[model samples]
Target: MDKINLSVTIAVITMFISLFLSFFLVTVKTEHKLSNRLFAFFLILNAIDISVNLGYFFDIPLNARVFISSIFFLQLPAFYLYVLSVCYADFKLKPKHLIHVSTFLIANLILLPRFYTVSLASKISFLKKSSSMLEIQFNHVLVHIQIILYLIAAFMILRKAKKIYLENYAGASMESLNWLFQFTVALSTFYFIALLKNIFKFTEYPDISESLKIGLFLFELIIIFWYLYKALNNPGLFRNIDSRLKLVADIVSEDKNSAQLIDSEKEYNEDLLKLKSYMMEKRPFLNPSLTIQDVSKDLKIPVRDLSVLINHKLEQHFYDFVNTYRIENAMDILRDVTKSKVTVLEILYEVGFNSKSSFNTAFKKHTGNTPTSYRKSL
Candidate 1:
């Protein structure tokens, strides 16, 4: 094998190994259904991508051609599902969902015969003296269609993910969504480069195909490694690191005869109740900027501890918990004849929402009815 092919092979192997480790680590460490399932799906898709690369590297046989062609079509839909899982924080696999996936698969099946026939024709042309221009043109057109379909799927996923990020969600969830968006963008860019290289293949470019393949392999390697690192590590890695330092300090201080401070249960309970009463009376969730940090400062608690309290005791994330309060207030407003002069948008803004779209989305999600529909029903 040439240096370029050897390099591409090593890169593909590294990506496969990283993906394998990530699959195992995520399975062991993550309990989140959506994240775990998405990682598993990514592992499968990465395997398919690697197989396709391997076939090109080896100039493999007709069977390899067919296998690669089939797997090529699998990448985009798997990626779309992965993005959906990250955005929603839920991976509910239903028959309807499977049906949607199968539709994409069916499209792949339609394209497969054309791909294999064209690949076979190209191989035959290389062996025989006679090859038609039409055969090569057909192959080129099919590949372009495949690239376009992949791009369309990726774009749709990105659009949905962006919408989810703009909606009120926990910081971690938002970060995850952004990460997926950036990853998809990177993948799209690499694919775009491949499309360009394909367009220029007939030109007398110096080893451009080899260079483009190596670039793609490196891109895949970087993405796989980055994603694996993020997935394997704990979500609150920095927080855990800080907690360990604090624990060591506590231990050393005890040995040094340092003063011990104890929190008073009575005072803590009183403060907790006071905060709850204020929230109930004033309903600060109506403030669009209300966040765990805001509440932590107002209530004199550490932000992490407050997050723990909400997640564990309240059984909801900060955003959902806050929105519940806002929706309750909205419900009351909708019921009041005195508030009949208030517009839906006015009520949405009054209750701490910055955007009518966000308010409508939250209202529908919480109540299973849009604000306008709910008001009409009332």
Candidate 2:
């Protein structure tokens, strides 16, 4: 098949898949309903954008085609908002969020006087000379700006969210946003390909530019199918941390030389003892889904204090601190002759670890041997 036919076929497949996924996300029951709905809206906007390429085949009206092309302005904002929703469970759509779509509204208004309001013959003339039109050039600039700003914003949000999860939650919670991270990486790849296509559009090689466009559609098809796989396999992937939670490093920076931050040696030792006592007696590490806040409440300590104690004073993340205790317990079980009949899998679960791979990793870190090797040596 020729380039146009191949590109059209891929676009059709991608749009249908994106539409199906969007509908599925909207209808699916999930704790992150707002996130799902936002992502579904993003997918719908993507479908609209893809439909822009097929307008010529269908003899679409010029006015309608011009209006639909404005969908480009909305795509990045919708995607950025979806990232925000996924990062924070408490995220809600408010009047303030409408500001994100201001560019899309402005783009339509800019087209109104020159293209939308013109007669049919004038509109045709405008299209034939659109590349030279100041309004069209300005819109192109806005799209490039959106592409850079929104994708960078999404990456920043994901990076911060991942850090918070690692510092405050157990090892099992580390991969909660892994799927979203992969999705963002895929989205970035799509934008990079588009950037290349735009650069090549003005070059001497027309065939190379057209080939890049077709390659983009092929990439889109791959991404949509990947999304389907992740959505089906990891339905509960959107676990979120409280957005208000601040990192221990930020807290320390604010009070770096405060007397309260530099507690008396006695008080420092006392807090350490208290934390160790609670861990031993309560075995909170065995909870599998434990977070620093959960331990703070149980110990009647402030989350900030607990964070400082474990994360800064102890020089370990809350995840690492908890897993250390879990690994110690697993070692004891591995050495115990009475529990020799118990499998390594059973011992890992009994000691509060949910995944065998993580359990084995922690075990190796704590002891220089795997669980089975450690048991056999005993």
CA RMSD per model (angstroms): 18.1, 2.4
Q: Who wins the TM-score comparison?
A: 2
Off by over 4 Å in 1: 56-60, 97-167, 234-378
RMSD (CA, Å), candidate 1 to true, equals 18.1
Per-model TM values vs. the true structure: 0.53, 0.91
User: Taking the tens digit of each residue's C-alpha lDDT, what string does model 2 give over 1-378?
Assistant: 588998899899999999999999999988888888888998899899999999977988999998898988898899899888878767888999999989999888999898999899999999899878989989988888889999899889988988787789994645657768888889888988898887787778868888999999888889888888877886665678778888788888877756467666797788899999999998999898899889989988888988988898889988889999999998888878888899999999999988777888888988889998898887
Error of 1 at 370 (Å): 39
- Which segments of candidate 2 are over 4 A away from where they belong? 256-262, 333-347, 356-378
Worst 10 residues of 2 by lDDT: 171-180
lDDT of each: 0.61, 0.86
Compose the digit string of candidate 1's lDDT tens values, residues 1-378: 586567667666865675686567466654455646656665666666566556655767864654554555556666666565554444456676564455335544554444444666764554253123443444456556766776677677656544333332322344455566677788788778877766555568847876776777777677777766876563532110011112222333563475442345675566568667878987777666565666778777865455544543445656677777888889999999999889998898777775566677779999999998999898
Candidate 1 lDDT at 377 equals: 97
